[model samples]
Target chain A: MTNQHQEPLSAMLDDELTNNELTQALDSIKDNQQSVQTFGRYALIGDVLRKEQELVSDDSFANSIQAAIADIELPMVDQLETENVASIAKHPKWYQRASQKVVQLSEHKLLKGSAQFAIAASVALVAVVGVSNMNPGQDKITSPVLNPVPLVQGLSPVSLSSDSFKEKPTANQVTQSRINALMADHNQQLRATDDKEELEKEDKKIEQ
Target chain B: MRILFLLITCFVYSTSAAATGTATATASTKVVAPESEQLQSKEQQVQSEPQPQSEAQPQQATTPNGEKINAAYWLKKLQEALTKSNFEAGIVTLKGEKTESYQWTHGFKVNDDGTEVEIERVSPLIGNGITAIRKNQTLSFFESNKEPYSISGVSIRNFIPAIFYKDFGDLVDSYQFVLVSKSQIAGRSAQLIRVESVTKEAYNFWVWIDVISGLPLRMAYIDEQGEVVEQVLMTHLSYLTEPNEEINKLFEIQLPQVANTAIAMNQQTNNWQLEYTPNGFELLKSDRHHVSINREVADYYLFSDGLVEYSVYVQRPIESFNSPLVLKDGGTSFVMVHADGFDVTVVGMLPTETAFKIAKSVKSK
Candidate 1:
């Protein structure tokens, strides 16, 4: 369950791994669903680390690659006909590889220039995904990630967030009923804004 | 060639979404208005609007400062276009994976005395005749149900955000507005205004207004990470000079029977008060409802900052043993916490931190 291979996946994305190591990492991503998903997550982490927020990522990309991998016995490294892989491989495009690594390195320099975002990758990642997958009693995972790095000012810290929580019935649905009662109150507020008379009443409250 | 391109694109973007936080917006939906029936479909959308109590106050049409293009100006334009103009627009609302298309029309009639009345109707483009109409404060429902009742409101409360119709100054303390960019939407030049929060970075709003009409063409709610969570885009827009005969006739159209119910008030108040609330957001109302003869009483307080709103509920702690809980759906956040012998739930589109803070703030009054 641990994301132990993220560093390797990170290196593989940068085209830095030796040929044998690259082959092994790609094979792991091809065979293991979790590895593929983790690689996808790492690629995203790399993008954030690189500060390339303009490029749009495709969510279905990993799934499509996984599905293709399940169907094809041959590895995808040789199937990249669109890329000049054969000639590049024959000529050892040393400058292309070096310049690309330099760009990735400069991405690190760009990240380094903003000391505020030095801890951006790990802290912000959990905040983004943790906000979506938040669950109670899971503070062990969500809380520790946010403790050290105080979020940017003007932004409040989310101590608790969950996608959905299934209440373990407590005192005959008292929790759920209270939640519904609040929404019912909100419904009244929604109606109040649309009613001119009620609005005047609110305006009077604000004036007072 | 397509597969080759797809494979390359896939590898290039697949893992990169996590880092950049920019996911491709789904393909833009296209709705073409048939030239003959766009506004002529008075049989559907063209009606009058909500209560006219506020319409009596008429300000100068445009300021003498030569059209100050600030947030206040655009908001004023939006309000004017909504209430002053007669038009039909095709609206598409996208929230998460849910998309709904609806037809909206507004018609205004000014009497000789100078007071204006409006008729408005909204019906989903695909449905079994679920339509809502507002004719001077009586919002009548026209569903297939045997009995239809009218509600007291200035306008139909759905389809459009409630904040758009209100004065923009109230929201000043909560959000700062900066005109962001100019783009084309619904075949019209659009100006985008970025409405980011002053206190919380959890959510923001982008409102795209039509430059000519000053009407909102599109609006979206984005999270702090620069991702649009919910949005509404107008597909077709047409302004009318005068109300058509059908819309004029709707002024006297028969409405469903009004419901007979007295407003009830529950007197029970929990020993609770909110410790902190964002500026300009005030308590609109407090209500107490007893589920079982006042034994399991829940107190509700609703708060709003003009355009954005959230609610707080306080009641006795549930038997379940757990820490604080937070959940999000679409643009809204729901938080639950245990405080001062009460289990509280704060629900609205506010950030989880704000909601949780409000939830835990309930204390003995």
Candidate 2:
């Protein structure tokens, strides 16, 4: 079977075959691993050419298509040949290099001008925002003077005490205890006055 | 960031310090009243005296006919005399803590419409010397300073009794009446009757009745501590007559020019009503009048028993520098309150408590 498939595939490869014979050879190679690898190389070359056509039309589309093609698993020889062609295409011949350098210099000049414009725009935006934040609603606006100390710091202690007092009866108990002490003192004074009066009455009775 | 934090801390410290300082100040101040003891002594003197020895002996006062002089008989006689007497008196009211005096000559006339009209001439005893004359449907203030300010509402007769008769029977009901020793009042020997309220909160009253005419000569109100709160002495009373030349002259005095503006304002905005008052206290006449100074409208309702006249004033709150509640000039007290939608001011020689209650009860719609 392998020998029979090779005769037709070689014929098809030499272009000495009909379309039917070539389709048959291609079908037979689908099940044969070594023939399938050779067929894959031919398909890759076609794919590269189709991709190159799409790339020349739209640059973004071309970059995406190229990235997709680069991700494919090509045979070792094809991969080596593609890389060599890509390097040659990047480095060009001496005359082409000179023309490419000229084009690159012009692009560099345009890019530099755009970059300067972008930088200036960004600087202007920052300055506007900074000035607005610094001085809002001019004429009637008054600048806020920053205090030296945090306002909340002095309030924290009293707030803590008030919160604690609300949670318990300690403050009320203290007030009630003070009231009890004063009442007790008043009672003592009244009792002492009564005792002194009684003693004075007893002395007057004895003298009588 | 450091400055911001410092500012916040300083603000907190100052606020807390202020709060603590207020608390400390409130705590540290000790009120000392050097004259309190002296006032108490004076109050004791007024209360403890005139304690009738007969209170201990209840059976001694029974007549030979065996009819006990009961509370009902005394109250009935007092009410009858009050209803019948053609009593009139010139009154002076002193507002509490105020230096100004308001003198008004008040008289009551029973109108043909079965209502009573009380005429009051409010004359300033001191500066500007303006007299505000009020008659039924006619109000004129005689003032050298401005135009004779005038506006008309209800008459003074409908206004006075509404103020004087709040809980009219309350004094008779709350107190135990005792016919005490005789006293001289208004140059006549009078029967002194002591009416003490059963409750400690009640103020006692001493009413002197004329021995021959049985008319009330004077009435004295004593506070809870038996301090004399006020005294009303009825003298120089004359029966009502047709409008005389002298009466016309008295009513013709105009209010001061400054007061004309106030009277006009007062005439524009006062609505007052009284629901129920005792019998014999008839609304003689009512009038709307303008007050010059504050430009307020006043409704004066006058009521009388052919004798004693009372006036109730419904107007805007009179702006006063001193006590707004008590306007006492001369011997009378004018109790004023801002209530409902209007300022209620009732001035008379009646007890201050009665005046206050009446002023407070005035409902404005």
Candidate 3:
């Protein structure tokens, strides 16, 4: 059904309406089912526009290819245009040559080539970084501290296990585990205490 | 004379109701004096009209007659602002040199049928850590590596302290609320209030509340020497007049089912007792369960003075570290002591000395 009050509904969603207009818009939208749906659609569109990053996944490589294709205006008579493009390829500038090449390549072939290049580049970069990280003479590097030190004083961070076990020669692994477990449980208990009380109140309400 | 007497009694009832701090009760009690049904209904409607107009309440009235507002009133206002205001804030938590940024959004909406809904979300600005989103009473935690789960709660216990969401009245016995001067925070004027421990058993909490919106602009934990141990600063805030588009979309999201299994079913009894808890500290809960991380069985007891809380664990003695090991992390102090046959550990946002004392007080009962 066509809604006569769609303008106010969208305006209310955009927060552009005055207080008096907002109340009037809300009052009208409440009675109309189509207007409510339109309001929801307007809100969803606004959210999509504002939080585009949050909604889209981290697939930038594919996005770049799609964006490149969008920038190239594909002709309606593609096969016929390709025949004409070959005949008119004389005296092309370097940039125009690159653009024409991109336009000539099919979309699938271009995507596959980009994907292969991205994978090979990432693999090469990983190899170089991994080799440097595995340097043999780096004696200063200890087993990367399994348990992150939660505390830091001024500049230096002192971990619970290392600081407390420095003087004692005994293996403090068990002690470290105990300390971590207790600390974790303490935080968990604090977080859950409020939930428990709320649950108990809900249970009481259900019982009553 | 009879009409005047009725008016006086009605005035007395209304004042007493206000003293009790219940607005609806005051409105209902005002109707008792009205003789005619029509007048009573109209009076009730007029009185209830102001209830929904909390936003229209003059901000200056918070500090009446140029007199400083009570700290508890500011805390109540903070709670109201956190729950009711439709705002998006960028908050950064500072602990030593480590800083973590978060995007916090809270919105309140009312449906056409008069049902109220609240949506609050906190997401880390950098990493894919836990993003907590609370829709009404169900709080859902979204993480990249784990399945999302939901729990029932009024607030998201993230960077903000849980005490801010709870009733400030519970802290009256333990904390001394002091109103400090106003300061500029995030370019907005803020009223500073300190919630200090009455018995010096916990770290003092200072909150700088935005004067206009009542939202917390900055909050810090100060030690005995008045050094800030850690702080959360609101970098910026956008207070919306109504629920924003993101908040409206959150209403449409179907949060995971409430994981009732997460709550401990039975309160397990422990064979240990703390002989020397702080003055206002009350036992919150005690249970015996395998520590989720290490799988070690330990008896645990939690104590809270409303503002801060501490957890005590009594586990079997282990011979790894020297006795009486203490560590301080930001505002949290961890104290562990190896007593005879058993070990006592106290973890909380209390001073190390207070935590040590509590850890030492754990005796077999």
Candidate 3 CAPRI classification by DockQ: acceptable
Best by TM-score: 3
Best-fitting candidate, scored by DockQ:
3
i-RMS for every candidate = 5.3, 28.7, 2.9
Q: How close is candidate 2 to the true structure, as a TM-score?
A: 0.27
Q: Using lDDT, give the best candidate's number.
A: 3
Per-residue lDDT tens digits for candidate 3, residues A1-208, read 5555688756655556666776566567555545544554454455457652123333552344233333333342232233222222221342243334334332212222322322322222222222222334543344332112423557532354344445444436787777777887887777778677756766887999
> What residue pairs clash in candidate 3, if any at all?
none
Model 1 segments more than 4 A misplaced: A1-185, A193-208, B1-69, B110-116, B127-130, B245-249, B256-262, B267-270, B290-296, B320-323
Report the lDDT tens digits of candidate 1 across residue range A58-119.
56533543454233222222322223222322233432342333233223333322222222
Worst 10-residue lDDT window, candidate 3 chain B: B8-17
Model 1: per-residue Cα lDDT over B1-365, one tens digit each:
32222111011112221211111100000011222333322322211112113221112233233322466666777777776656677899875556789888777766679766778888889876567777766778777764666776666656566777766776777788886655766445566888777766347888997654566889898877788877888888765545655457766677775565745667556457789886667877677865332345668777777676787777777766464866666677778787867778788877677778787777878
Tens digits of per-residue lDDT, candidate 3, B175-224, equal 87888876666555577998888877788899998755677989999988
Pick by DockQ: 1 or 2, better one: 1
What TM-score between 0 and 1 does chain B of candidate 3 receive?
0.80
TM-score of B chain for each model?
A: 0.73, 0.36, 0.80
Task: Give the Å error, residue B259, model 1.
Answer: 5.4
Candidate 1 local Cα displacement, residue A94, angstroms: 74
